[model samples]
Target: MTTAWMNATIYTGEDFAEAILTEDGRIKQVGSAEDILSSSPDRVVDLNGRFVLPGFNDSHLHLRHLGKQLQSLSLSGTKSIQELIVRSRQYLKDHPDRSRVALTGSGWNQDQFSEKRFPTKEELDQISSEIPVALTRVCGHVAVVNSRALEVLGLDASTPNPPGGIVEKKHGELTGLLKETALDYLGPLYPELTSEDLRSQFQAAFSAAVELGVTSAQSNDLSGSNTQALAIWNLLLDMDQKGQIPLRLTQQLALDTFEELDAFFEEAKQPPSDHLSMGPIKLYKDGSLGARTALMQKDYADCPGERGTDALSDESIRKVLSWAQENDRGVIIHVIGDGALERVLNLYEETEDPSRHGLVHCQISTKAQLERIKEIGCYVLAQPIFFDYDLKVLVDRVGDELAATSYAFGTLMRKGVSVSLGTDCPVEGVNPLPNLYCAIARTDLEGKPDGGFHPEHAMTLSEAIRAYTAESAFQEGHADNKGKLAPGYLADFVVLQHDPFQEKPDALLRNRVVMTVIGEKIVYTHHGERSTTR
Candidate 1:
């Protein structure tokens, strides 16, 4: 089938074009509308001078968690502890059935609260003492549980803190706060959903992606045991084979042990469909900055003597990387602190190929580290939207010297390191526009800082777009076939109402995705009148 998308303002990275022709799900031609129309294509789409660019590709996120968050109790924008309690009560009142199950909620930040403190077990006990309650902070690295949850998990003041994790306590009493690996204990308490239930959740998540013009994603659904993880992977593959999902998926397997890695490799040896493919193994080198759990070179400015935590020891990381190198598999690690970045980089230099392994959330780094990243030729997966919240607390956590170097996308790009942008959804929402805006503006949604936070480190609009598109595709080994508008490239692109390059940084926050096309099919359209094919 031949389709001509005409009279469009196409940003082809290197240049602009008036039209593009697609045949059999690949771009066949690019030129002026008149030139394309002379061929008398089977179908013609008039974009009416709308903006067209390669579809957004989120390099890293948790798809299943995003879907689960959509249905669960969310304290995402709760401003105070009282508001959080009120919302939790209201959710339980609305969904009386969830009372029996472990009540799970996410997106509460202590920094956002008026008291600037994590909600305690006592605060949550007011809502329910019978039901086990666990609410995750926005960073996903910390969680606060009620007394009931602590009892359910068998955690007490006598219980020792697990390696690479924290169980907060005051004096001799447990405070019901868990950090890093400590949160893993809550896994068994979650009720398992049936395959049919999973299908519904996956469908909801996939629909959400396309609606935001996200044609592709690299997702890590890391919950559950090895058997369950494999099942989830197979289920997603089945969905792709059955055409139940439209967005292209690159699954980042979360293998905790060598045994699980071997098992995953055995199952993933088979070739995947065009829309689905197995990606790198996912690992966490350190925790998140929000909870002060990220391993850092120096102590947090506000809290003396605290350098955060490392999820994996140097020996463990070396072992995992050695295994990956020997097996010819790539790895994507979650590294947030400068200390973690330093350690992981040293390991990458010694045992593995940095190009094949990516650093996720390289949020805190020095100029030296940035130089090393470029020299090592590894990909940096960043969530620019993190600035919306991190900007509020970064200076206090780390001194201004470190804070200035944090989230340095422009510096990374200038240093020749490939940087890709993602929202790390459920941490921040899965909206690409806001992320793009953050990259360009270096400010929160409200547009803080007169110029922008260290505007010197800000990326140009074009650079930001490339990070969200071509650079993201590169991370998944799809740059050759996707992420661009050249001939032979997949016909995956998005149509927008405003030209991103022409609009001011703040204006992009309101920019709407008018239409989304993947593999020559219109998967999402914001309004009927905005899209038409003849």
Candidate 2:
């Protein structure tokens, strides 16, 4: 059936269109309402001049992980160590029958806490001395678990440090702080979710993405663990083939080693679904700035003589990159610090990047490093929302000089580097509006700091929108058809209550998704009712 959404202020990406004609899940035409109406469409829906744009494409996120986070207890904005303890206890008290074997929660930032320090396992023990309690830092790189958890995992001061990870110890004693690979290996040791439950989680995550106007995502759902990662991948492919997944998902496979990757290449089936396809491999090079585990050239401003943890070694990463390039695929590594970027760059210098490898966070770097990135034609996927949290503690973490060049996405764009925007959801929330606001305003959701934080680094309204849409699709090799609202493009667009082009930046924070359309389907309407009259 053919349909025309007429009388709408539609941003057809490059320009505006008075009406859009869609048929068979693709745009047939975009022009003046009179011109489009002349086509004699089967149905007409008058939009009364609402703001319409291409549906958002979140460049990077953890879909399976985010789904799990939705079910797990969240302590995102908890501002005190005492509050962290209290919330964990309260959640257990509130839900007596949730999970008895292990209690897991995330999103606790030590910087925001009143005590201004990492919560020890002893503190987590207050939640339950019987059950293993593990609370991850907001960055997802660091986690603090109770003594019971350590015992259950058979980790102690006597245990040797795992490669690419740390079992953080102080004064020759166990601190229950696991950084990088240690946390990754032990994180899945908790009671596993059933296949049925995993399906539900993915559905929940997809619904949340669609509700926020995200039409597609390059998600890193597969963990480094071999068996579980492959299982989850197969499940996702099955769901995609069955049309259970709503949004387009390009998987960024995370295999722990070359052997695991080889096993995957040999055993994995190529999915036939358009919505589910292979993306670049994801490698972790460092931890996060908030966790004080991000590898940096200089010692942390707050903690003298202590740079963060470097998760990957030159030897392992080189082998993986070689494997990826040889297999005609790309790799996007998680590099958050200047030192980490340098380390990755050195490897790229020795390799031939036919698929153009990328840096996930490319967040902290010098002007020279960014210039080198541009020189290498390496694209970056950045989270502007990270700036919102960094604004308060940046100086304390990286000193003024480094902080100035850090998170400079605008600079990268100016230097001819392709930069795409994302929320890195579950690390932040999966809301594109707030992430867009942070990109445009260079401030937090509340619009803090009079002039905005590093205002020069802020992207314009059009630039931010493009970064979230066209640029995102471009990065995933889908710009030819996805991330645009035009003739022949996918009929995916969103109607917004507020026009970001004309309204204040804050309006984006308060703006609502009036309608979200994917192909011919109206998946979400603001008022919980579909109202497209024929």
**Number of the top candidate by lDDT?**
1
Query: Candidate 2's residue-wise lDDT over 217-272, tens digit each?
Result: 88998875677778888898789878998888888888848888888878778888
Candidate 1 residues lying further than 4 Å off, grouped into runs, are 269-271
- The collision pairs in model 1 are none
**Shift in Å, residue 249, candidate 1:** 0.3
lDDT digits (tens) for residues 1-534 of candidate 1: 799998779998668999999999889988888888998999999887899999999999988888888867888989999999899989888987765677889999999999899999999897788989899998888999999999988999998899989899999998989998889888855787888878888888888989999999988884455787888877887788799879888888787677777776677544367888888888888887878888999998989999999898888777778888888888888999999999989888885478998999999988788888988888899998999898888899998999888899988997788899888897888989999999988998889977899888889989988999999999899989888898999999999889978878898988989889999898988866465678
Steric overlap count per candidate: 0, 0
- As a TM-score, model 1 comes out at 0.98
- The segments of candidate 2 whose C-alpha lies over 4 angstroms from its true place after superposition are 185-189, 528-530
lDDT against true structure, model 1: 0.87
In candidate 2, the residue pairs with backbone N, CA or C atoms under 3 Å apart (3 or more residues apart, or in different chains) clash, namely none
